[model samples]
Target: MEINGVEIKDTYAEGFGIKVTRILVTAATEELAKIAATEATGYGTSVIGCPAEAGIDCFVPAEHTPDGRPGYAIMICQGGKKALDHELMERIGMCVLTAPTTAAFNLLESEDTLKTGNKLKFFGDGFEKECFIDGRKVHSIPIMSGDFLVESEFGYKDGVAGGNFFILAKDQMTGVKAAQAAVEAISKIESVITPFPGGMVASGSKVGSNKYSKFLNASTNEKMCVTLKDEVESDIRADADGVFEIVIDGVDEESVRSAMKSGIEAACAVDGVLEISAGNFDGKLGAYIINLHELF
Candidate 1:
């Protein structure tokens, strides 16, 4: 398949099921809200070295926020319930709660469960109080600047993780430009995040190890590397001289597919972009293999 002169591989992207939690961060100003939300979602690219994958979900204007200030919604995904809870406590407490004039709230609601506010209340050091509104519990933690309010419990749902695509270009600048275009395209879509470094990972991995005895999680796709183009399989090799990968995580297969399709379309419109591709295992994650052609 060709999109605006760029080749689109007829392959699929594989992903797995993960638990996701959304939190709302409000602040006195829009800049503060952006800072708090970005900080809370920082360092959460991939689950390999990080506990979860997170990013700014959306921005809400003052009229939509409780404090009449700008706010942002953030989503964090973990492998399981335990990891999700732990990450939520640490990130929200240390990042959002500590930020100036910022407050946290649960974007999700549950009937009977362990609430995030209940875990974060300890940060108040005994000055914390709880309030019930519309049957939802909110914790008020006294801070130096003001009070930080957070919801007691957050709702968790199964989400799709690791939907990805590759942008092959003739040079680093071209690759970067293509990736930027793709990011901009995907950014407009809801419920998806490009969680790699700077929302794009230059170095992508394969399924398993080819060498290195002690390396249990080493999988290198030499074909995707320009320097190793002569040393790997031709099918996976990039026709261009440079390559970059965009990894997306979303609420479901359709959301991911939509994001990927939009991103690829945007990237392919740029110059020096030769082909668009995806990363996947051989049916290992059969539950969420989004076909590229079907998406386009």
Candidate 2:
């Protein structure tokens, strides 16, 4: 298929099931809220090495927040309940809870939950208090800056992960422009996030290394690399000089499909985009085999 003169490869992106937690990080100022969110999501681009896959879903206005403060919607994704439990403690306690004038709230309505706040209230050294915020039960912990607020329980549910697409262009600048366009479009989407840095992966890698499988968990996609075009069985066209991959994780398969369609269309509108493609492990690696053609 051709979209805006750019070729769309008939392929699929492989993705597996995961647990997802959506949290509201609110603060006195928008900047502080964003800072806390960013910190909580740092080193969380991919699950291959990071403890979780996370990113800022969108910005919420003060009036829309539960505490009447500006905040950002952040999503943390893990392989299962156990890993998610550890991530929430580290990210929320060390990142959001430590930020100045910031408060964390669970946004998911899932019945399954974790007593994240109840676990962290120990930081108060036996002086923590139970409270209600806008009808939701919460815990107030005393901190050096002020009282830190966190919902008593945070909900989590099964989600989708590793849905991705590749953007091929004539040069790095063109590739970056196209990728940025895609990220901007995907940002408006709810219940989905592009976890890579700036929502774009410049150095996309495969599941494992061909030469040193035991030494590394992942290796560069040589076929997709511009520099190795001649040495390897290249995937890009002769004229294609740059390639970027965008990975989307969402609350469900439908949400991921919507994000892929929107992001691909937005990227195709940019000049010099050559083709759009996706990564897959022959349906051997993931629970979902999302076909690119099926998206449209």
Candidate 3:
């Protein structure tokens, strides 16, 4: 349970079953790949808050990319077919389609027919063109820099969503540093991504509301805030003064557990890190149960 001097909790992180699609964005260079990846994953934190939960999954070296440029893989998570389709349409249309010298492709190779590029083709205002590459249909949308290519549709598979961990530290700097280290670790792992803001969310939420409106499904956990430590149920360690949550989405429970284990190990190496814990709804989410201790 001890990673260096930091304590890893014996608790588990729970995740529910959701449909996931992998999006490959390729650019002319690493800088463009990073920018496109950031944009594609931007504005995507929570399903209710944003349209989907997405992040950069990995980077492909130039030799591996289609255009012989650096590329990034991103995972988009949604609850169902309709949500996934709709969100992908919006995100691809707005983010990937707008980026310069970039192309999008479906990570999944499936026979099931879907229409991702068919929906986004509207952005071309009828001037769009299509091509077949390796038997996959790709659409090209004219932009300022050049044409942006995207696959017709991405493959859909059931995946684990909402795998998360909290990094409690003695201060904001420590917490942020820990988070950065964790992101670096997670980025190296395949099939997992941190979708929250800056790969971390400070405002952790709990199930249901206390005094809020009936329509609200969840609200912020004020108790987790350092300022409210005196008035709320304190779960943070005594030496910890700040907290940040890392929310991960993965293709499966095992992938999530591996990513979490790697992330926690990297995060605990930093100074001022007190403990590593996870967010869960007990066993409500039956599909993915990531036991932190077992994972590490």
The whole-model lDDT of each prediction reads 0.82, 0.95, 0.83
lDDT of 2 by residue, 46-139 (tens): 9988999999999999999989999999999999999999999999999999999999999999989988988999999999999999999989
lDDT of 3: 0.83
What TM-score should be assigned to candidate 1? 0.93
Instruction: Please rank every candidate by lDDT, starting with the best.
Output: 2, 3, 1
Worst 10-residue lDDT window for candidate 3 reads 105-114
The root-mean-square deviation over C-alpha atoms between each candidate and the true structure, in angstroms, is: 1.9, 0.9, 2.1
Sum up the clashes in candidate 1.
0
What is the RMSD of candidate 3? 2.1
| Candidate with best TM-score | 2
Candidates by TM-score, descending order: 2, 1, 3
Compose the digit string of candidate 3's lDDT tens values, residues 122-196.
788888998886577888878788888888878888888888899999998999999999988988899888888
TM-score of each: 0.93, 0.98, 0.91
How accurate locally is residue 240 in candidate 1, as Cα lDDT from 0 to 100? Answer: 78
Q: Against the true structure, whose lDDT is highest?
A: 2
Question: Distance (Å) between predicted and true CA of 9, model 3?
Answer: 1.9
